[model samples]
Target: MRRRRTYRLTGGLAAAGLVLLGIPPAAAQEQGGLETQLRFSQRLTQEDGTLSTTTGLGVTLSSRTRTEAFLFSVDSGLEQDFDGSALQQKDPRLILSYSRESLSSALAADFSYRQSDVDALSEDDDISDGVLRLDEGLLKRYSGNLSLQLGRDAPFGGTVDLGYSAKTYSETSDPDLLDEESVNATVALRFDLDPRISAGLRSSFSQTDRDDPGQDTDSASIGGTLDFGVTKTLSTNAYLGYSRVTKSTPGFPEDVQKGLAYTLSFTELRPNGDLSGSLGSDIDEAGRRTTARLDRSLELPSGALRAGVGLSTSEDDDLRPLLSFSYDRGLKRGTFGVKLDQAFSTDSDGEEALNSDFRVTYRQELTPLSSLQAGVVLRDTDFVDDANTDSRKLQLDLVYRHALAEDWNLVGGYSHSISDKSDEDRDHSSKVFIGLEKATRWRF
Candidate 1:
């Protein structure tokens, strides 16, 4: 099996150093329980780029759990970037939990809080942001043949967990930059509702406090999915969802996000030659940013292979299409695998502005006690979108692992990456890192 080398030895070193220095650890006895981690990385660029480095240390502790049905669970973690300014400071998470179930009825509730601080290179003011989320649901099972669920989901939590907003950070804080909060409700039911058909419904509301003059908005989404079995070897799942929002800025009071996404799958469910495929799309009344995808999977005798093709066209006159394939083979020593990806893109003018990315990876187990992996990656960008965008990129990485004991293990790794942009020379750069990590854990 292939695995990502985890960073644990860095934390141990810090812990050990404190002990040898006759210094008490920051929270040795200050809290609920002790679980911590540390990681360090370096970033560098060319004369056209820049170089940066960072180390990260984090600790999470929370009140003991009640364990009783309907009780809550509380947890929290504090992380600091040694690159100091790279990832900044993060206070991520708090979760509340409750659940109850019987032969015929059940209820559940959950909530969480998360937040973080941003870096300065993003051209905005330094800022603090996060979110709070709460949800509750009730379910019932009827005659061992039917089941139903009714629930409410609220994302009013002011945290930042969205993938799109992740890479974009601010150099400063703007108290006025609105946060996001949303609320939604969903209901679903299942049965041998016939041995062939089941249905569901969902409705949700969300609002954003965006920095773009035309981006701040509020919207509600309503959608559902259907699953049907056509035969013993084939089943299908299709979902259609839509949303409409009231914009926060003038001249645009309403915005709509509607789409149809679907999939068809076939499985031996018994292990011989399982296959599946899916097609989906997201388009609106204006078709400003459109996305489409086609995916397929094959269960080969050697292992399993999956492939996908997708295209995305955005309102800003940007178009991108991507392709990927992966294969997994179980070897006697372990599991071996490989993957590939490529993306082609153009500007609004339909001119080739950027051709980005191609990557391949391989992993193998040398023996019961040792394993290794090697991979290479490359990316190219026109930087037509922004001066900060990269015009070129190259990366390579290698890793090795060996076990010390059932609970103990050691790992070492090396990685290098480079990026260049046509518009900006000062921002071009390269990064290289070599590190080792080890871990040992036990349960009381």
Candidate 2:
């Protein structure tokens, strides 16, 4: 197991100083607030004919001064399985920010931190080139940004921004899985050219280090952007840049790559919604890649619709297409929604894969204080190079909620899921949960 030294202490201390400086005596005497919630539930799984109990608790604290804001929250849970095994999960988050504006200048700083599960696949995991799987490993991330504007009220005003971010993952059951550490820094300077146009120059550097097998990569890019509004409803942005990347792997040759990068985008803000499109190309350790995307959204009287399409060519010269659509409607006494998505991409190993998902949900108001909701989701994944390694999943859920009081509620839900994999046995699982939830808030 490997770990990186924590770097959040400096930002934390700076935020604390800002809080103290920004809060006046009168503001400090004013009230801050805290909110808390707790729930307990029981679950059943049909695959192994097992029952489990779960409990969750959450709390949030928030405060704001005349020129600063602060928020802290924590969520923790424990699950006890029928087999006598217990799983514990905890997520804690913090946000702190300060902003000040004077006659000629403005300054702002923001910092955030979070610890949670690795919820999705990341590009940095490509070293394994393995099939994507659900990982329950804990992940910690920290980020901060600061911006300063000079001559803010002037037509030729300029703004400078600096940012840093880092992420780490741990607590994996699989010894083969590698822990990751990464840090990123970016700086940008922009000048207002006109009332409807601006220009900016940006530079960024990042490094990612992985343990098992020991790999490290460093990347840097410098770019310029031009933003202009063609009309009140239309606008365009253009960018040109160059990037340099270097990677060192145990078994692979050390390589340094450099290439040009550019992007052009257009956006239309319609009365009802908006439409946008973009095309971009860049080079990195994985080689040169190009991508294009288009998105549109519209609002109806009682509903909303959104759709998007994307296409990209990977370093391996594989072309992948992505499509997605979603629609939601609110009825007099109910709500309905549907979503569909199809995505194609490469796994960590640069192997092409396709993933598709479809979901439908409906909710009906049974009474003024109660509601019934149901949903179904289907997912499919296919590996292009390994057709026999395909997988599919189907899930169904029904939930009922009743308001008991202004701060109390009763919740019950049932869920069932089935998963099928090529050359593997099918797995079926189900759970039923009934719980009373209480929420409380205080100001002091």
Candidate 3:
């Protein structure tokens, strides 16, 4: 079961890569800049009636360069914690891209690399088809893509994209889950029927392979979409497609799955807010899944509010629900915000789980060069199939920042956290830190 869940995590990475390919690259400029920061802090933790203290130092550096046809950026950070359980961490990332345009066509290529914790990444940050998995531990990921478009200015346009991604996980207790890799290719064509209507046809193919478990999956799909404006503020889009998937695993029978998929969506734009809804089915590394979502947002006088609800069902007859809401408001002297989220899904070990989170934060300006911030977070998780596995966590934080110079600052913070589990005693921890930070930026 763990191996199967690991396979699903790799599938999410491929889906995330496809989403990245869909976004247009930023235009190149002639300016460049560099920024760096350094900080020192102390932390304390208590567990099983024992308290421990740790000191840490952190540094971050980032630089960006842009030219006529190329853009590049590098960001890296290092942290060293000195204590009995001392853990040294390094996170480095790089992005490079080149784009060229001609009279009738455009060509672009991009490459990116990053090393970080796997749970820190989220597919919900972009457009996704409900294929998401949660995993913890350190990971290194590399991705590259090439895209070309012909006749972009004409009534008919065509685009071709090819991409590859690989990920390796570390710091895991289970060594059976190793590395994963994938390759993807897509071709799409669009025809402009008129100024307000367009039709598109797209085809995609991908292959995913994993080590340790020795499994390979191949998937292919073709789809068409029609987008039309019904009125100045209203629009409708529809898509229909079919997909086929084949999976091969050692010591098991080969599995083949085929299904029909479709998506119908509507959006309305207003002066103060917007509303959108969609229903679709698509084939992912997990075979096939159907999903529906509704989202709404409103612009208040002082801030904004947003809410969303979603539902999904997989080919294994498992159903899940997702819900989220957030509101932010600005007062004369302070800002306040609150957010709530709930998700029902499978965990990394393929266990059924339900998780809920609630958070609230407030910030106020004490003076022109000083501010105070406070926040609280609460989480509840329950494992449906596992007995005595429910847990709850609560955390509170307060921070004060004061500017001492143009490029230097002082920060003091205090945090308290508590965790309670079924059939176990409660654990508590508290931390207080005062740190000085220096930041500088240079432009060229």
Candidate 4:
């Protein structure tokens, strides 16, 4: 029921800005549509043996056209203890998103803003970094992206892309919640000598800034790319480049590294699937890095499967394994999916960590107007710089929905989660909730 006042104001202003941006002269002339939904709910939660109840309201608005779209949603309410005392605002949340794309050219832009609280086993909430925190806090996220291409079908063409993202957290004891921001841009030009062969030049720049001054870093690179068709269904791409990275930490001398970077990759297309493999080496703030991976995707009669495996080695570490796998199957009046991924990744603070995630989900249609959904998620994180900072998390969710009438539905769910860290006691949380939801849509 606690929140950051500053972040709330920022989210409100951002939402207003996006709404204003959604209404341009071009969009005003095109066919547009609007959809709204409202939900009222009551939830009961038990955290570490303490019980509380919440009554909440949720609202969503969506507008869209052929080339542009906008969405805004918010949830807020009041909560109290079993004794009906200590009433406070429910953990409030707000999200705003907008996207636009040019129909004639390869031009697109996307922007999104989110403000939410990090609570144990909360519904409709997710941590951006995917690492569960042992404590609770407020998190705000902002991101924007733009990309465009010139002369996509010409012998000579070019493309440009830009991206930015920032994540900030307040009122939390979690060590991994340090605020961070990143910016990236890339430009490329290509010329086609023949239908099956082309060459291009590319330049890119990226920067990562963190609340920890020691983690701030920037890098830039220039490269040449060649695409060759080996056969009708086979192709190869090669890149040769030079890159430089600089790290500046307070009270310490600046560190700079420059080196040659290169990559070789190939792809083969099959009747119903494809296979690809790549090997690359690069230099960054983390140090010199080399990696190789192979991936394959296949379409089955009633399902699909995709998997990948790789190995990565850095200047200061031995070879480490990486894996990715996902499978989805269609059943009679139902669907099921499984996913698993294990790789070296960076946390919100730009620190290196090993992440392993596994998830399984299932949905079944109980009747024409009723359905059931269930999921299980398991996650593990190990800091590369410290041995005592490992953590594991497990969560289970089950929900059932039944239509009561037109534009009305009944919803009930149960959720449980446990967090186990090497340096802290296990944290457990669970919740049960039932609610009614109504939705309507119209176009102008």
Residues 1-444 of candidate 1 have per-residue lDDT tens digits of 111111111111211101110112322323333333322222211111222222323222222222213222222222222334433322222334344444444455544443333210111111122211011111111110112222222211111111112222233233322333333333343333465776655554444444444245455555666778887767887767765644445455554554443333333343544555555543322233455656667787779888877766655546676677777787766555555544434221122233443545566788888777666555444433453234454545555666665433454455444434443532222223332333322212
Backbone clashes, each candidate: 34, 2, 0, 0
How displaced is residue 243 in candidate 3, in Å?
A: 0.7
Work out the TM-score per prediction.
Answer: 0.52, 0.74, 0.71, 0.82
Scored by CA lDDT, what does every candidate get? Answer: 0.39, 0.62, 0.62, 0.70
Ranking by TM-score: 4, 2, 3, 1
If ranked by lDDT, best first, what sequence of candidates would result? 4, 3, 2, 1
Which scores better on TM-score, 1 or 2?
Answer: 2
lDDT of 3 by residue, 133-219 (tens): 234466677889999999878989999999998878876654434577879999999999998899999999998777746567788
Model 4 is weakest, by summed lDDT over 10 consecutive residues, at 11-20
What lDDT score goes with residue 46 in model 4? 49
What's the lDDT of the predicted structure labeled candidate 4?
Answer: 0.70
Evaluated at residue 423, the lDDT of candidate 2 is 45
- Residue pairs of candidate 3 with colliding backbone atoms: none
In candidate 2, what are the lDDT values of residues 330-444, reduced to their tens digit?
Answer: 9899989888777554333234566776778788899999988777767666666654366676767677778886656676766666667654657565555566555565655
lDDT for 112 in candidate 1 is: 44
Candidate 1 local Cα displacement, residue 435, angstroms: 5.9
Candidate 3 versus truth, CA RMSD in Å, comes to 7.8
